[model samples]
Target: MGSYGTSMAARCCVTDTRPTSNPWVVLATLLAIYIVNYADRYLITGLIGPIKAQFAIGDAMVGMLMGPAFVLLYVILGVPFARLADRTSRVQVIAAGCVLWSGATIATGMASGPISLTLARVAVGVGEAAFVAPAYSLLSDYFRPERRGLAFAILGLAAYVGQIAGQAGGPAIAAQHDWRMAFYSMGAIGLLLGFAALLLIREPRRSGSGEGTVEALPLGQLARCLVRSPAYLFMMFAFGFGVLSGVAFGYWGPELFTRAYGMDPVAVKSAFAMNFGLSGLVGMLLFGALSDRLARRSMIWPCRLSALALGAATCAILMASWAGSFGTARLAAIPAGLLGGGWSVGFMATLQYMLPPRIRAASTALFLAVTTLLGFFVGPWATGALSEMMGHDAAALRLALTLIIPFGFLSALLGWAAAGRVERDRAALHDALSIRPAAPLLARPAAEKG
Candidate 1:
């Protein structure tokens, strides 16, 4: 884990007059690489129809592909990689993850059936597991705390941007060629992008004490420390419940849309992905920016309010999106995306604000393991199981998505509480530890990090 608060003096040095390095430039580069990261990772969803047709399996198999199979590998490897990120160059880890996932996605293009594709997805998830935590730590190194919400918002935008390309662009590409080509082409693009990321960004100087060695807490000590941090617990809980609601529904999106709207299966596959892809982008861009501005101005828990708003609004929209007429359903999509994207950026900020730079990556890996199992591995799979148990009803799936609303309400509570104490905790910890600014904190753009 790297230190998040690199000291106001060091932060000012970087933020002031460029001082030779630009955090914003670093931020932009990370965002671009993230776009490719996402495109390679999510392009598989656009190929669901062809994959299913080739395998002749049902939603159960799809659930495995999107959920447990991917998550299991992601969680299993994420912690160790987090440690690696702390030890090695985070930029290197990110670049390696990009290459690994891209290679895996390319392999998926050649998969003959369910097991092969599932294994390939496993590799993709494992690679992705390495990217995010270290990247966040690097980002904290890149910018000052005051600018963190915006920095995080920009990084969060990658989720939407990458997804848009994967969903909208992927379908068009798939339609023109084939699903296999879609995977192959995106993977190839990502491989090239990884090289660019590696070349464009050099590792920034370390922020505190200019120490290049990664944060190294013993496993027991790390676990004990995390247990004491309310912020960390709340962060994990927020994401845990959030994912249980949102990711679960997202996993089953095509089936729900097809059953409810009576669309062609192939079309639903693409449409479902694109639907989420587009609306999610808008919600993230709008709500994320708005939330950051409000947080900066008022600091009264903008993320919490945003979460509450999205939960309440999307509950109605989720129902409408499924039950209403086609046009109405399309109209409801905006709110649906509000729930998906709004909390993501805000929640991420909360998580970052909760931990110190020294332990953030490890903390990230810890929560990721828990949340990955609780949400990605089981949420979608259980929803599908419940949907199946309920006679595989579309209405049942709708009911499953409604779970997000209440879970989001809980996340709002957590976010609200976190907002109040996050800065206080950050300050208290820094003062108590007599934290110092690092030499590298003033040197480079984007920390040349993961």
Candidate 2:
């Protein structure tokens, strides 16, 4: 197993000696695209009330729209798209994805019924699935291993930015125009960004000393290698639990604020935008920088920091769920957003350390598959069903939110456990594969060898 791991590393990992241009430009462009990416996807959540009234539907149907309508195809197509990213130009894959999803979002505006809207959302899923894995893979190449936490965290900040744009802007547009116009507007923004990505972004050289000497490893072997690692399994499960709680709240929290606190749609949208934007941004920057610093001491610190942050996030979320007033809920959301920001930076940064370069994109796709399928699909759907079962009232929604809190704790615990094993896994990869930490972009020689 060790020998195979070493050989795989030697075959797959590229050591790019060619000096690159400012990688931060690449990071900024990708970050902008993700902001648009998330804004288009999450815009629907803020408009749930208007959509429900328009279609004469209930919370369960809205949950389906948020969850399964997109996630099913999103998870299914992730691997194949990720494979394409691995084999071809990642920038092109991302540009194509942006166009496809933007087009789908525009079509959603024309959705006259639930069926048309659902199909449009499914198309959005297919487009988005193409973006994430490849994007992560691209970022990994632009930044060094040590700096990835911050780079990825900067990318992760898009979630909050996108949500802010969607939640704040979507409802405001809907208030004046209608839900359909909001969709059309956001979709148009994405289309513009997609074209910019195609024109401005340049693909970086893949790293590894022996890149042309060996063929890429088969996907079967990569899957087998990952499955056999205790560290990978633990990290994925931890990510799964965290994503489940996070998605459920993100998708449903707006409705809860409206129903339970009697806030207007505009008020809910603004509050959510501010809450996610300010708090999540603080958390991402703080924890991402912290993780990078602590990682200098030990690989385990990132996971440990994540474990602690997850616990903080869980407590904050619980406080928000039970808070009687809108102001109190917003206050609670601060910690939730801030701490929640750390999980991606910490765990994913840790995962980057463990994985060989060749398989990074696929590993990310697999991570997304598990998290999206269970977290995005089952989490919101189950919450909606639970609320309906409990009577479809604000109180029932509160209860449903309460039930998912345990998953947060479970996730924190998994991170704690995973922290202990991360070093061992890193050691195994190093001892067997002779892999060392990657040099930061521009640190190597400027000349490329033919």
Candidate 3:
């Protein structure tokens, strides 16, 4: 194995500066795009009631529209989109994706019923799929392994910003003008931002000679390498379950308040925006910084912290499930959002540290497939199904939400199990990639390797 210490030192240096590139500029531009990403993605969640009333649908149907309907295409296309990002200009890909999703979000506003709206959501998902994996790859190039937790934390905060805007603004817009206007306004904002991303964000020069040339890895080889790492497998599975819980809350929490507590959609969404969204922002920053610090002591620290956060988040969500009033739900959101935010920053940092730059985007796509498929595809639908089965009332929804909390504990256990194996798996991957001094170390083109 290449010396772990040497590789880490090299990564730290690479992260510090690209000499010609301004990473902050890249980050700022991407942040704007991500905010639009979530705003378009979750805008519907805030207006579920109006959509349902118009279509005369139940919770299960709404859940399907929000979850699997969108996620199917999102997860399915992620790998190819990531491959495109890996082989092409990531900036152009992201810019194009932003435009596609923005247009699709606008189409969502034009939908008259479930069929048209669902199709528009599918298009939105496809556009979003193109953005995230590549964006992570770009950020990995901009920041070093040690600083990645903080970097991803900062980027992850865009979700809250988007959620705050979407949840708060969507309901407000819907209240004043109608739900269609809510979609139209957010879509317009995203379309403008898409053009700005194309104009403003210059893709950084690729980092590290470890990967030699900018050649794509064969998907088979990439899969083989990942399958060999137990840590990666466990961590990915942990996130699958972990995100299931998060999606359950994020997609349905607003519904919970509106239905269970007799709160106004605007009031419920705004309160969630502040309580849960802001709490998550705090957690993302705190745990990201904390994970970075602890990682200097041991690679396992990131996993350890992730497991800890999952445990805390499970408790917080369970508390919310049982709360008797809107005020109590707000109180419960604090730790749930805080701890939930840490999971992404921690796991992303850990996973990136273990991967070669050549396949980082692909690896991220793979991870997202699992997480989004389970969390986005299954969680929301399952919650809605349970709520329907139990009686389609406030009490039933609360019970359904409570039932999802146990999976959070399962996620924590799996994350903790992966902690002991991270360093070893990281070394294994480094060795497999066959590092050399300065020159790119990964496989050259097929002809060159032959």
Off by over 4 Å in 2: 1-21, 212-214, 427-450
Sort order, lDDT high to low: 3, 2, 1
Candidate 3 local lDDT, 183-287, one digit each (tens): 899889888988988777766666664433478778877787788778898999898999898888888887888888787878988898789999988988998
Candidate 3 worst ten-residue window by lDDT: 437-446
* Model 3 backbone overlap count: 3
lDDT of 2 by residue, 108-218 (tens): 999999999899999999899989989988877777666778888899899888888888888989989998999999889888888888777777676542464323446
Leading candidate by TM-score: 3
Residue pairs with backbone atoms closer than 3 Å in model 3 (clashes) = 209-440, 210-441, 212-440
List clash counts for every candidate, in order: 8, 6, 3
Per-candidate TM equals 0.85, 0.90, 0.91
Clash total of candidate 1: 8
Give the lDDT of residue 378 in candidate 1.
78
Question: Which stretches of model 1 miss by more than 4 angstroms?
Answer: 1-21, 210-215, 266-276, 297-303, 313-317, 393-396, 402-406, 427-450
lDDT of 2 at 125: 93
TM-score, cand. 1: 0.85
